[model samples]
Target: MSPFSLPSKPLHLALLGLLLFLLPFAILRERSYVTIDDNLDTEISIPYLLTRYHVALDYRPTAVVPPVMNGLPRNAMRSGLSVTVAVFALLEPLPAYLVHQALVRVLALLGMYALLRAHFLKRDNDKALAAGLALAWAVLPVYSMYGMSVLGQPWLLLAFLNLRQGRSRWTDWALIAGFPLWSFFVFVGPFVLVALAGLLLWDWQQGRGISKRVLLGMALLTILYLVVEYPLLYSLLIAKQFVPHRVEFDLGKLGPQTLAAQLKSAFLYFVTGHYHASRFFRGAAVLAVGAAFLLTPAAKRRAVLRQVLPLLVALAVVALFCGFAQQITDSLQRVIPPLRTFNLSRFHFLTPLLWFVVLVLSLRWLTSRKLQAAFIALQLLIGLGMNAEWLNNLRELAGRPLPDEPNYQAYVAPSLFADIQRYTMENAGPPALYRVACLGFPPSVAQLNSFYTLDSYQNNYPLAYKHEFRPLIAGELAKNAALRTYFDDWGNRCYLFSAELGRNFRVSARQHQQVQDWAFDAAAFQRLGGRYVLSAVQLQAPARSGLQLRGVFSARTAYWRVYLYEVVPSSSPKPGAAVGQKLPEISKFGLLVCKNG
Candidate 1:
C-alpha cells in the first residue's frame, strides 16, 4: 500500500539505471567520445561561442560571433532564450553538455511515465509495464542539443489529450506554455502544430465538437515559440539582413537522382529511423506490433486495424517523402518559394514517438507480464547499443579505444590548440587580428579553441560570404565533382576544401596523409583576413602554395599534429590582378560573384 511500492519501485530503478548509463560520461568527462556528425561538428560550438562572447541575449541584427566565419550572425545559433543555452552559459562546455544530457533523459523518463500512467496504462499491473517502456524511450540516444523536441512529445500528447477531454488542469496549461523554452521550434514545433491541427479536423469529422481548450493550448504553445525564437523570426522576416546561404540551397542537386536510390532511402528510414531522432533499431518493436495485431481475436481485428493502420500509413508517407525529398522540394519550390530551403522532410522527427506509441499500444494487447518484460528488455538493449556515448564508454572500459575515434580531449585537442594559440599570439599578435582555416579537420575544432576562423559549419550564414569564401576553395571543388555538389548545392559546411583530402574532414594524426599537389589561393585567403592554416596533415611543398611552415606542434594526448602555415607576406595579390583566376568561377555554379573580385 506504500507510495514507493510496485510501479514506484520500477520507476526508481529506471532512474538509477539512467544515472548509471550517464555515469561514464560524467566520470570520463572530456575523455568521452560523443556523437560528432551534426553534434560536435556544429551544435556544440554554438553554445560555447554564444556564452563565451556574452552574446547569448544579443538580438541585434549585426550581432555576430567573431570566432566563426569572420562573424557568423548571432541568429544562426540556437535562440539565446532556450534552457539549453542557459545551461551552457552557466557552466563550462563539457559540464554543460553532460548536465543537459542528464536533464533531457530525466525529463524524458518522467514525461513518458506520467503520460502512460494517466492515459494508456492506468491498471496497477500496467504501471510497471509503463515504467519499463518509459525507460526504453528515455534512453534513446537522440541529440541532446535538440533538447526535448523528440523526447518531449509524450508530454505534449498528454497535455493535448487532457485538454480535448475537457479535464485539463493548471499543469496541462503550464506544460503547453513551458515546453517551448526547452524545445526547438524549427526542429519539432511546426510539425507538432500541424499534427495538432490535423487531430482537430479529425475530431470534427468524427462528430466531436472542436475543443476550445485544445485550440487555446495550441495557440499558447505557438505564441511562446514565437517569443522564444524571436531572433530567428527577426533574421528571416524582419531584419532583412544579407541573404542567407540557404537561399541558394539546391535540393535537386543534393538528393538521390535515381528512383531505386530514393526507395532504398525510404525503406531505411521506415525501419531504422533517422539518426538525429535516435536510430533505435525498430525490428523488435515492429515484431511486437505485428504479433499483437495477429493475436487479436478475428472479431476485434477490424477495430484494431482501424486504430493502427493510420499510424503505419503515416509512417510510410513520411519515409517516402524524406527519401524523395530532394526531387519533391525541387518541384514544389517552383510553386512555393519557401519550399526551396525549408526542410519539409522533418516529418520524420515524429517517427520516434510514433514507433514507441505503437510499441506501448502493442504491449497493452499482450496479457502475459513475462512476454511484455522480455520485449522491454530487448528494446532497452537495442537503445543502449545504438547510443554512441554508451558504446564508446564500453569500448573505453574494455581498454580498446578505437584509434580513429577520438575522445573529447583528443577530438577537440584543447591542449594542442591552446599551444597553437599561444605560439600564434606570441608571434602573429592576438587571434582577433587574423583569421585561420582548417585544412584536414573541421573548423569547429578551431572555433571551440577560441580561434578566429574564416571557415565554419553553419546551417545559416550570409550568401555573400559564401561567394567570397568560394574562391579560396574553387580549385579543389573544380577537381572533385562530389565536393563541388556538397559545397555549391548544400553549402552548410562552408569549410576549407582540398582535392587531396576530398570531403574527409576528420583527418587525425593517426592518418599519415599529406597534401602533395596542394593548389591553394593564399591571396584570396589573405583577402578574407586569413593569415594562417592549421592543418592536421603536412602540406608538402608549402612554399609553392605561398605558405611558410611556421611550426609543427604536437601533443601526446592530442589527435592532430598541428601543421601551422602562415600566408607569406608577399602572397597578397597585386591590385587589379585576378585571384584564383585559374580556378572555376563562382558564377559557374549560378552563384553571385565576390564583390572583391
Candidate 2:
C-alpha cells in the first residue's frame, strides 16, 4: 500500500480511527496536567503506599498517616483516596492520570452517542449528526474542572443505557454491582431505580413489562451490591471523618422553598460547570438553541416527540430522586444544621445531559446546515477556550523551574526531595522517619518530597486537628485552657478513633506562635518528627523550636525564600502526659520580607 492509502485491515483501521479521534485531547493533555476537583487528592496517590501514609498522602481522619481507623493502625482499608492511589499505582505514573481521563472522555462520548442514537437521532436526515452532538457533549471541558475521580460515572451511564435498551442480563448485574464502589455514582442508583420503574410503566403500556424474573434479579442484585459495599456506605453516611474533608455544607431548613432553591441551584451548577461557573456560555448556548427550537414546524414536532418523551422521563426520574434526597437529607441532619457535608454538585450531572438531548434535537430541526455546523463549531471553540487554563497551567508545571524566577510555583516544590534528603536526613536521629511541616510553600510540596507534615491542608486530616486544635487556633477553645491542653495532648494520638485514645504516648503541646499563616510549636516542632520546616516567610528563628536555621534556598531573581530548619527533642515528655503552650507564653513574632515585594 502507498503511504497515503488507508489501512484495509479492520484492527489497523480501528487503531487509525482512534488515533485521529484522540489527537486533540492528547495535545491538550500534553500541554496541561489535570488539576482541580478530585484530581487534587488523587494526584497525591500517584506516589502513595500504605506503609508511609506520608504527609503528602494525608486525606484521612486517622491521626496515623494511613488512617488507623477503629484503632487498627495496621488496617489500611480506607476507601476514597486509597482507591485513587491504587488506580495510580496500577496505571504507573504522572501522565497516566491523563490517560484515565481520556478514557472517561471516550466513555462519556460513547454514552452520549448511545443516548442520542436511541432517541433524537433515530429519525434524523443525517445519521452522523448524532456523533457530532455526542462530540459536543464530550468536549465540554467540564472534566478539566472536575477531574475524572468518580470512576463510577461510566458505569452509571452503562447501567442507564442497558436498562433503557433492555440489554442483556449480565451487563445489568455487573453495572449494578459495580456502582456502589464509587459513592458518587451510588447516588445515581436511586435515580436509576426510579427511571427503571418509569421504563416498566412505559413498557407495560406497550404490552410488555420489564419481565418479573429480570426485575427480581435486578432487585436482588441491587441488594447484594449494597450488602457488599455496606461498610463503605456506613462510613460515608455516618462517619463525620469522610463527609466534609475539604468543603463546608449545611442542611437547609426543611421546607419547600429551601428544596426548590437547592433544586434550582443544582440545575444551575450544570450550566456553570460548578466551581467558578466556568461554563456559563455552555448554558447560554443551550438556551439559545432551545429558544430557536420554538420556531420549528408544528407538524415536524412528531419526529422530536420520540426524543422529548424519553428525555423528560430521564429528567423527571433524576429530578424526583434529587428532590426526595434533598428533603430527606435535610430532615436527617436537621438536628445539626451546622454540620457540614460534601458538595451538593453530586446531583448536577442531569442538567448537562438534558442540555445534550435538547441541543441535538434543535440541531435536527434546523433547516440551515451551515447554521447547524456553525453552532457546533462555536460551542466546541468556547468549551475549549473555557478550559484552556487547566491545560495552560499543566503545561506551565511541566516546563517550569524557569531560571529567571529560579523558584517554585503553584503547589510545587519539586526539588525539596533532594533538599531535605541532603540537608535534614543525613543529620537526623533514629526513628529514622522525620516529618517536615511546611509554611510558605503549598501543602502538596511536602508530599511531593515524601515528608510527614502535620500541617497538611489536604481534604482529609485527623478530625481532631480540626475539632480540637482548630478551635484553639481560632480562640474558640481558649475559654478553658485545660481543654486546650487536653486536645494538645490528644492531637498526637488523635489519628485513630478508638477507646484507647489517651493510652498512646506522644509529645505534649509546645509553644506555638502564628506569624501570618504560619503556625507551629517548639514542642510539636520536635515530637512530630519536625526536623525541617520549609517556609517562605523569613523569621528570626526562636530558640524554642529547637529548629536551627540550617539553610535558605533562593535565587536573586526568585520572588520567595524557602527556609529549612533542623529540630531535635532534648528530652522526652512523660508517658501519656499533656501540656498546652499558649501564644502568650511564646516569644513575640515579627514578620520580615520573604517575598520580592
Candidate 3:
C-alpha cells in the first residue's frame, strides 16, 4: 500500500498531517510564543485559577476567586463544566494547555473530515479532497481555550444536516448534547441557534416542512448549554448579584465612529476575519469562490448560486454588522434592553465556518485535481502565515525571537514571582493578608503567582467595584484622555492606569521605562488594602507619588524588573487602615461580599 494513499487509510494520513502541524508547539513547550492578546493575558489564567483554587465545581452564590480583583466571583470565570477546565484540573498549566490544544485540533480534523465525507464530498474519488480540506480547517490559528466553538462548526452543521434529512442517529444526537459541554455559549451558541432558526425558516419558505429532529436538536443543545453554564446564567438572570461593568459598555465610544472607518473595518473583517475566530488572509478562497460562481455554465449556474449565494450574503451581512455594530447597537439599545449589555456583534463568529463552506463549494466545481491542490496549498500557506503560534515557532527555529513578544516561561516567570512571593511573605505577611495591584502589566501575572490582586482584567465584574477602584487611577485618568475613555466607557480592565505608560502592559526590563511625573493616589491605594504596588517599570519620583520603594527584584529568564513599592503611611492613619488590616464593608454593594475582606 502506498503511504500517502487516501482511500486505503485517509484517517491515518490526516492524523499524521495534524501531528506534524502541531509538532512545533509540542516540542517548544514553555518556550513557544502562544497568543498573548486575549489568550495568555486573560483566558489562560481562568482555567488555571479555577483548577488551582478547587473552585471549578463550586456553585455557591458568594463563591469567589480571591487571587483576582480582590475577590472576583467564581461564575465570572469560565464554566466549571467545561472540558478545558477539566483538562486544567487534571494536569499542570503548560501540559494541560498542550493536551487541550491537541484535543481540540484532533476534534477539528475528525469533525471536518466526517462532515465533508458524509455531506459535502461523498464521491469515492473525493476522499482526498475532503481529507485535505479537513486538515486545512483543523490547522487554522484558532484559540483552543475556546474548545470547539469556532472549529467544531463543521461537525455541528453535519449533525443538523442529518437531522434535517431525517438520517440522524444516536451519534448525531450525542454531538448536539456534547457540544455545549466543550464550547462556550456566550461566544458562539446564541449566534449558532439564530443561524439554525434561519435555516429552518429557509426550509419552510421552500415548501419543506419543519424538521422536528432539528428542533429537538436545538432544544437539546440549549438545555445542555444552560446546564453547563448554570453559574453564568444564575449570575445574569436569577441572582443578579451585581450590576456588571458591561452595563456601561458604550459601543459608540469603543468602536469605529465614522462611516468610512466602519466600511474599512467591515472590509477587513470580510477578507481577513477576526482574531478571536480564526483570522487569516482569505483572498485566495474569495477569489476562487467568486471565479467558480462566475465561470459556471448557465444551466448549472442557478443550482450553484443556490448553494453558494446564501453563504456569501451571510458573510457580507455578518461583516457589515460587525463593522456598523456600534451604531446599530446604540440606536437599538433604547428599545432592546438586552442589546444594551449583550454584544450583538458577535455574529461574526459564524463567518469562519461560512467562509470555509464557500471554499468547499467552490473547490467542488474545479475538475482539475492539480488546480484544486494548488488552491488548497495556497490556503494552507495563508493560514500558517497568519498563525502567531506557527510564525513564532518558525522565528524561534530561525533564531529570531521578537523582543516584545515573550514565550510562556519568560511571560509567566514562575520562578521570578516565587522569589517575589517569598520576599513579600518575609517582609509583609502571607499573600492572603493584603491585596496588591499591578503596574505596566496585567494582574493575571500576579494572580497566577497566587497573589491576591486589587486590580484585574475581567470581562464582567461589579460596577460598584469599578467606581470604588476609579479613585486610585483618577489622577492619571485626569491627565490622559485616552485612558479616561478606555476606563469610563469600557472598564473591563480595571487596572492602575498610568498616563505616562498609557496602555503598554508588557514593559520589559530592557526598556527601563520610568514614570517620571507619577500622579498616583497613595491614600486611595491604602484605603483599598493595596499593601504593595508591583510595577514592571520604576517610578523615578517615588516620594512625589507617595510611594516608598521596598525592593527591586529580577530573574535571569524573566522579562520584567519588578519594583515593589509600599504605600506611604498617612501621618494620622485611620482605624483598620494599617498595612495587612482588613478592608471595610464595601463588598456588600451587590451581594458580592469578599471572603477575605
Candidate 4:
C-alpha cells in the first residue's frame, strides 16, 4: 500500500489532518505564555543554537557553557522540542512550544493508525478498527503541561509503530537514539531496551531473522555521532570535565512518600475519563475488554493471542520499569527519587498505550452494522470531548497568573522581569560586551535579559566549578563576599564565573556567588569585575569607597526600591599610603562583601 493510502477512508484522512491543524491553537490558547522551564530553556537554547550558527544573537563571548552543555548545538538543548526547533528554526521565537506539541500529537495519531492498519491487513481484520484505536489513544487525557517534550507517551507509541514496519533507515535510527535525550531517557532507557528485545523475539518467531542492515546502519550512525562529538564526549565522559558553574543536578521530590504517591498516581492516570475527570466506570469498562478476550473460542483466542502477546510482553516490561522507577522500597527511594510525578505519571507514558487496541477490538461485539457504527462515533466523540477539556484546562492555567519566585505580589511577569531587563539593556555596556549580575538572586529574573548575563541557573554543574568554588557549593564561603549564600534556594543551583563577567576591572576571586543581601564589600565588588550591580534594595555608596551612585531603576513607586550602583575602580592612590582602607561596615548601606575581594 502506498503511504498516502494508509488512512483508507477520505473522512478519516480529513479528520486527521483537520485535528492536526487545529490542536496547536486549541491547546495553546495560552498565547505566547510559557512555563518557567519552557521560557528559560527555549529562550536560552533557541538563541544559543541560532547564535552558534550565526543566525541569531551571539552568546559565545559570554555563554560560559560547560562541556556537557555543548553536546549538540542542533540538539537545541530541548527534549522532543529539540528536533522540532532545529527543523523549524524560524518558529523558535514564536509559539515554538505550541507548535512542537502539535507536531508530536499528529505523529502519535498517524503512527497509531499505521501500526494497527498493518497488523489488521496481515490478519484480514477491518481497517476501521485501526482508525478507531488510533483515535482513542490520541486524546488519552495526559500531557506534560510544560511542553510535549517530557511526554514520551506519543513518541513511545510511534517507536512501536516503526518497529512493527521492520524497516531500517539512517535517519530513523538517528532520531530514535536522540528522541528522548537528557530527560526521560536519563532513567527510562533500560525498559525500552527490553521492549526492543521483545520486538526482535516476535519477528524471529514469525520467520524473519534480525535485519543485519539495521545493526550495521545503527553502528555506522553511532560511529558518526561519536566522531562528530569526540571532543565533547571525551571531555565530559572520559576526562570527567564539564563547563564550570553552569548546569547543576539536584535530587527532586525524594523519599518514600513521593514514590508511593507516584505509584498510586500512575495507576489512576491510566483510566481517567475522556475529560480527564475520574470515571472509574470507564476504567472498569477498559478492564472488561480483557475479560472479553478470555471468553473467546479456542481458535480465535489463539490467533489473537499471537499478535497480542508481543504487546503484553512489551507492557509488562514497561510496567516493571515504572515500578522500579518509583523506588517502591524505602531504601531505594533514599537513593533514586524518581523524576516522574505521582500526579502526572510521565514516565509511564507507554504503559496504557501498549494494550489499548486489544480493548478496541474486543468492543466489536454488536451484531448489527448500525450499532457498531454508533459505537465508533461514540468513541470518537469521547476522544474529542476529552481533547476539548484539555484545551479549556490549559486556558484556565495560563489565565491565572505567572508564578512569582515567592508569593510576593510583585508580578513576576510585566514587572520584575520588565524592570530588570530595562535597567540591564540601558546600562550593561553593549550587546557584545559586559555582563550583568544580580547581587542577591541567581539571575532568575535576569535570565529574561534574553541575551548574556553573568548569572546562571542549571540542574547539572561541573566538578571543576565545585572544586574552584568549594565554599559556595558547600554553603561555606562567608564574609567579604556572601555570594555563596545566594547560589541556592529550594535546591536549584545557579552559578556564573567572574571571569565570564568581563575583561575590564580586574579583581580578586574571579567569581562571586549570590549573597544574603545586595550589599557586598563595595570596594571588593569593583575588583571582582562587577561594573554595574542591580541591588534588590536601595543602598548608599560604601561612603568614601570607590562605589558611585548610578541612576536608581524603577524607584519608590515599585514594591522595592531597586538601586543601581557602578563599581568605581579605585583610582591609583596618590603616594598617600592608604591602600584599601576598611570603608566602614555600611550595614545601613549595602552590608556585605565579595569573595576574597
Q: How close is every model to the real structure, measured as TM-score? A: 0.94, 0.64, 0.95, 0.58
Q: What's the CA error at residue 542 for candidate 4, in Å? A: 14
lDDT of 3 by residue, 223-300 (tens): 999999898788767777666778788778888888999999999999988989899888767877776767777788
lDDT of 1 by residue, 1-597 (tens): 211124488788888888888888877877887788889988998989999998999988667776777667677678888899999999988888889989999989988998888888888777678888888999988999899889988888889998999976888888899899998788798999988998899899999989999999999999999999888777767766556788788889877789999999899899988898778778767878777778877787777677767887888888998999888899989898777878888888899988887788777877778888999999999999888778987787677888888888888988899999999989767778778999989988888888988889888877888888899888889999999999998899998888888888988887877999777888888777778999988988988778999998889999889899999868754665433331123222211221122
Q: Which numbered prediction scores highest in TM-score against the true structure?
A: 3
Candidate 3: residue pairs that collide: none
TM-score of 1: 0.94
Q: By TM-score, how accurate is candidate 4?
A: 0.58
Candidate 3 Cα outliers beyond 4 Å, as residue runs: 1-8, 571-597
Q: Write candidate 4's Cα lDDT for 476-577 as tens digits.
A: 234323333334211223343222122111111112222222224443333222355554533433344335566655422133334555566453223532
By lDDT, the best candidate is 3
Give stretches of model 4 more than 4 Å off.
4-30, 35-82, 85-88, 120-129, 132-191, 201-232, 238-285, 294-317, 326-419, 425-428, 431-445, 454-459, 466-597
lDDT (10s digit) by residue, model 2, range 155-224: 4554555555655556556655655543333334454455457667888898875566447545854775
Off by over 4 Å in 1: 1-7, 572-597
Ranking by TM-score: 3, 1, 2, 4
Q: How well does candidate 1 match the true structure, expressed as C-alpha RMSD?
A: 4.4
**563: Cα error in model 2, Å:** 2.1
Return the number of clashes found in candidate 1: 0
Please say which candidate is ahead in TM-score: 1 or 4.
1
Query: Which of candidates 1 and 3 is the stronger one according to TM-score?
Result: 3
For model 2, which pairs clash? 33-394, 56-447, 62-495, 63-495
